[model samples]
Target: MQNEAQYKELKEWRSQHIQAYLTDNKKLNQFHDELMRKVFNKAFQTIKKQSGEPPCAFLWFVVGSAGRREQGVASDQDHGLVYETKSKKYETYFKSLGEELSFGLNEVGYPYCEGNVMSSNKVWRKSLEEWEEQLLEWMDSQSWESMRYLQIFYDARSIVGEEKYITTLKNKVHDFKKGHPTLLRRFLDNMMHVKKAVGPFGQIFVEDNGAHKDSIHIKNAAFMPYVNSVRLLSIKEGIHATSTLGRLSELCLLPGYKELKPYYENFERLLSYRVSLFKASTTYDEVHYLNIKKLSKDEKKEVKHILKNGRKLHEYVQKIIKKGC
Candidate 1:
């Protein structure tokens, strides 16, 4: 209903507001969660009004890496939806509502997920019962594909949804793990593939080819392995802590993982180091490494030691998986 002039003015005003908010690192960092929650709530309310439905009638989740609360600045949208049991006549209407929400998100600068893992995708938009069956099927098989699917699902935490639905999913994961030890093994084996980031001579390996050439894949090399390892351990221990750092803390108190406390400390240090380096880089697509020549001998030695300990931790995780931990 807005004329062109008013629409352009509003868009410019929003752009300026976002720029000002983001430019102040301390304020933006402190307000990140609050801002995202407000954005999602606004989107939900707008969609509900358009669909003429009660807000509590549907569940929403921010899925994938964002759902895991491990997003980088370049992350895209990955979301899911579950609706209450409704008459067949309302199915199309709910589906349209999902599409509207997805489009609205894109307007707000969250790019659509390249893999179509959005709420607009029927595969991800489902009834609560359908979501349960999908999870059960993935847990039962533990094939390469199944493990891949579960890795994404394992990261899921509800952003906006029926609280019971989130709890139900967590309970299902615990129940499934209780009887499916081999599935755990498969997941661990898949996680071990993350060792590709280490070089043969104990150096941190950066990609040598392709568009990402000469840069370390920080997400894959450092963060994903750490996150995946924590996920595997948490699932085995029946702990539902969602964040990688949180999972490590919870595992420290558990009976069998007492020896892993030092490893967790090392992991935390490496994570902080990587995040700081990434934030300092001029480009988000490239990893930043301190020039070896710029560092004192002692600093160089410390860097090497950190990398060695990280590699060792990865190896230790492999051993634990071999022993069916």
Candidate 2:
């Protein structure tokens, strides 16, 4: 009754037809999200059948890559739970549900999060009030770790049951920031240290001596600045789109960004490179590191343009923050 059978179909499609789906980054993410939702529903139904019923209304939300709907072919579980009431009964039920979902995803090729950012982790599973308290504490602390966690939560998207739980919480965050405009600068500081992917003289930087020696860390160098900068601006502007491209398009409505045209073009080029890179990515680790030696002259030039524009984007966002609400 829970559409549990969809998991098998989803897994088979991913395993067998991945090459066909690899062309569009947006479609790839949408496919991943669809499968994840099926997985979550199956876990919920399976758990409830075994344990009678949930003690209260609860919602499951996805975070991290899944939350943004911007995942690559290989992504892990990053999720959380928000039950309506906090009690021993509800806690036990949701935690059990969390483990089932995580294990279920692992069985179907998606890895468990290395950081344990999954709903199975106690830190990520909470009642609605507890989550509100936790968010407030995180905002108050303003430590590096707190900021990291807050950013993760800010990207969350509700996947199953009581979607408003996540929506209201997201609204709370928006309101908190609205009341505290200066915090954008703090977030800007946290995002400023993107690794230098392209060096002076337009050279592509690579790892010199490691397992991935001579490979470029595209996640940090190529993707993060674009994603992170767009995220900061979207948050400041209260634009609710989560995907990098979606956020950029929304930002276009503001002055100085015409249809989000310029930045979107650069990010689109970068995404195409990432998609092409996936053809050679046999393993998860291989997806985020580009082989500098492999890029043709035009591709390398495009990569440099992406890096330059990304830096420009972040600097522009900083200026917007300084200009204030």
lDDT of 1 by residue, 92-182 (tens): 6557666765665565555688878887888777777778888888888747877777777666667665756766876898887778667
The local distance difference test score of model 1 is 0.63
Report the lDDT of model 1 for residue 98: 67
> TM-scores of all models?
0.79, 0.92
Q: Candidate 1 clash total?
A: 0
* Candidate 2 wrongly placed segments (more than 4 Å): 1-13
Alpha carbon lDDT at 141, candidate 1: 79
- Candidate 2's TM-score reads 0.92
lDDT by residue for model 2 (162-203), tens: 988887887778888978876787778788787776778887
Q: Quantify all predictions' global Cα lDDT against the true fold.
A: 0.63, 0.81
Clashing pairs in model 1? none
Candidate whose lDDT is highest = 2
> Candidate 2, residue 189: CA error in Å?
2.0
